[model samples]
Target: MAQAKGNALGALGKLTELRQRIFFVIGALVVFRLGSFIPVPGVNPEAMTRLIQGGGGLLNMFNMFSGGSLQRFSVFALGVVPYISASIVVQMMGSVVPSLQALRKEGEAGRRTMTMYTRFGTVGLSAFQAFGIAAALQSQTAAGGAPVVYTPGFGFILASVVGLTAGSMFLMWLGEQITERGIGNGISLLIFAGIVAGLPGAVSNTLGMASNGELSVLRLIMVVGLVLAVTAFVVFMERAQRRITVNYARRSGGQRAYMNQTSHLPLKINMSGVIPPIFASSLLMFPATAVSWFGAGHQSRWLQGLTQAIAPGQPLYEIVYAVLVIVFAFFYTAIVFNSQETADNLKRSGALIPGIRPGRATGEYIDGVMTRLTGVGAIYLVLVCLVPTFMQNYWHVPFYFGGTSLLIIVVVVMDFTAQVQAHLVSHQYESLLKKANLRRN
Candidate 1:
């Protein structure tokens, strides 16, 4: 660990570009955190916080994703949720819509077109959700009977729609900039930042509980140990891959003499990464938020029941959440890592898996392996995401300790470190090349 730290520092010192990228990511995230305090135009931040503090529900999860922005009634309360939701819709459509599927296959042009569609969808979804939230706040009250919206009217709604929509759009742009200019994936890093921001507070609260005798010292120790163990497990699983050895065809007496060569096709155990949990949570949050908003205005038996049912930690909520996570794990894995395409590329490169035949047979074999791997991955996701909720219920573990939040934090950190390593390696290669050229000269 000490050597690893030294290597990172050494690399950052030598690799100016990597250091700049890391700095850019840090600066961008700090800006994001600051923006979380810029409140929405007409909403009462105190009242909103009171409403959240009153109980646990969808608000907790939303606040977690927004880095407490929802509780503050900030313009960024929506965060990148709209963007993510739009991505899900666009990707799903790309599968079914013939035109979209063709466009998706069109390479860079297709990507740009699909991205444009997703942006449009984000604006539309942002406006829609913004409207719902504004309208809902009109009827919502704090524990002290204060209205969440100070002046509920068309004016408030309009201002909110504009402010919130722009905030989401700005975040979308910010994330893109980070991806192009910084380290790791911009969107994932954004969500990771949000989740990480709340971690310290969660730790403090958990300790506070122990101090207050609400949680026994022994239980606290156990929770801490369990959390560490689970984190190690997550790291292990994320790094695990199924390696398929591909042997290249031997060539003799050609322009370039190519002897038999071997390389491994590395397929990650969780090829979908943290997308499944995040997407699953976003989907569930939407319907629950809608029901909560609508129920606030016109209270009824079913609506009240629904408000209770879909809240995180509820039986109905957990069951549905688990199912959605599993579904997305498989769906996204299929989309992102197509076994057929991988096999085709390998075949085109004159490589073959030792036991499997080339072409169609290879595709089938890889697909079969992927299917089994995805099943295991999906189960792992479900366990990681839901077990925290279970612990929160039974063990009273802090909110940040498990579930989607932990998964995202772990995965994003891994991705960022991997990118940094790659950059460092590239820098080393450039230095070697320069040295070789100098020697040759």
Candidate 2:
């Protein structure tokens, strides 16, 4: 009874802490969503609505990422995409640049410096993207022939560039604050929030389509069923891991000898998590986004052809996206989990892999295993991302059905749940320690 009571008390304490964190996250996201509705100066609200409703390729993707900010030509239209892009660039550079690689070895200080650099890069990228968007809006006309921007001039462009850039930076700051004070990764939570915010609208749109005969009931059922299946698959795969056994030699201290300790080094199947898909999506969207700036409504024959080829669900686009996801899966896995470093750390701790030598051979073996795992992981990501594309092409389902958005939603929810559980466990441990001390006293 005492133990059960202790457990209850511990859980209650942890629940209180978890509640605070959850509240902080909710408040931050509420702020973000509110900012998404504040339109940029000179943008015609009605025209913006029509353009968004029409849904061009790049514009749709941007709107999705921005939580519909781009649809309204809001100040936060650029979103945290630039920050994500900057992080990708900085991380990729660490693999190739000797200085960065050395700095990466310096621990927390180096991480702070790298974060500052990423912030600078985010500002620069946001400004560039904001300029492109401003220019594109100037040339863009809705389906009803109304211009998206009422006043297209240098003044409008300058205000947009400043406003959009400031909004993105503020969002970046909010994400950082969430990471420090809230639960889960702040940037990821921001993206997850944005994606999830559209769920209600997606469901409504699907129902409307079904009612209007644009979509059959069977097709809607299939889409919903597929989304549930994909989400389950993602959850299963994310939890899957390969455990490599490690043995630590017995140590002798004074007259007593410690027994050999056995443990396992767990390597997750998807070591790169959602990063590969996010990177691939960003890279694939870049060309289309850039083209939208110069060729909003009017495009040359070649430009038009290129745009079609790279548009979502296009054969060429799918192929490139899959390839990029695979490549980035390997690349990010290598960066995060270095087999040599792992082997070295184990060796230093007097541990060795079962039946493997404690040096180069162990590293090679671990690397080979990781390579195979990453290959499978990459294929899983590609399939998960492409399933929605296929559904959209054939069943004409919306983009949110089963792609990157679904993946992020599943992964983030799993991660957040895990964090909450961890906090609860810690609280329980602390309670047990206190009880033990009280008994001794």
Candidate 3:
């Protein structure tokens, strides 16, 4: 009873210390939401909605991912997607470009340089995307023949492009700030917040549909049950890992005795994490969203046909999306874990798998393990993301509450919670050490 009480007290104390960190994260999120409401100058925010809805299909998904910011033509309309996409591009380039590859191997300095390149790339990409968006806005007209943009000219284009690009940069800075000074990954947490911001609207829409007899109560209940079940399953799979036993030899100095230590290398079931879904969703958006700008004449006959066929919820779209998700799962897994590097490091450290010899054998063994694990991980990712995706397509359900968004939300939240707990544990350890010193005194 006393031990339990002590533990509870310790937890409470740790929580108290974490209150400041929690507040900082909350403050940043609040700022983000506020930015999402601040429309860019010279745009009719209401008309922007009409334009987006008029475009249809994939733009809606893009708007949803941006947390309704895109639809509003808000300051944060661009979100952090440009940065994320640029980062992905830069990473892919680093693998193929000799200079970038060499820079990548240079440790902290290399990483800092690469991060700078990513930021530069983000600006370039954001500017290009913003220009495209500005051009699209100029061509859009309301039902009443009102212009979506207050004025259509180079001035408006320049201003909107600068505003959106700057907005993206600001968002990137905010995310970095959160990561450095607050709890959780700033960029991912931002996306999570955006997705979650749509929840109230989604729920209200569902209720409205149910009231109008568009969706039966039984169907709604079934959907909610399915979402809950999927959420639970994702949580379980996210935590699941394959543990490999590791043995470290003892090395003693002059008079000190050190014991050999043993630990388990935890290989997570979903090693590629939330990256695959993000890649798949972003890649799927490029063509579909780009076509919306073209008002019939802008698109070639074949391109228009392609747009209709490949838009979200289409059979062809789902198949391509599923394949991309699987491909990225393996690709990203390989990038994150290099078997040769791991084996070499293990060999240098005098560690070997139970039966496998060090060096080439260990590399092959690790490669084999990664291949098998990645296959499972890829299939798991495809099922979790696609099943609910297809449900949305077949049943006319909202994809917001479906598996892809839910997977990202759950995984990001889990990681955030783990980070918070780690900080709390460290704080408790410091307190214990301080008390020990006091007792010694």
Candidate 2 Cα lDDT to native: 0.85
lDDT of 3 by residue, 251-348 (tens): 77667665567776677878888788777876777665666666556446676778788777788888998899889889888877778888898778
TM-score of predicted structure 1: 0.89
Tens digits of lDDT, candidate 2, 161-272: 9999999999999999998899888988988888788889888887888999988889788877878888899999999999999998877787767668889999999898
Candidate 2 residue 32 C-alpha distance from true site, Å: 1.0
Q: Which of candidates 2 and 3 reaches a greater lDDT?
A: 2
Model 3 segments beyond 4 Å from truth? 1-16, 253-260
Off by over 4 Å in 2: 1-14, 53-55, 250-258, 283-291, 296-299, 310-314
Tell me each candidate's TM-score: 0.89, 0.91, 0.91
lDDT comparing candidate 3 with the true structure: 0.83
Q: What's the CA error at residue 249 for candidate 2, in Å?
A: 2.5
lDDT of each: 0.84, 0.85, 0.83
Q: Ranking by TM-score, best first?
A: 2, 3, 1
Better of 1 and 2 by TM-score: 2
For model 3, give the 10-residue run with minimal summed lDDT.
290-299
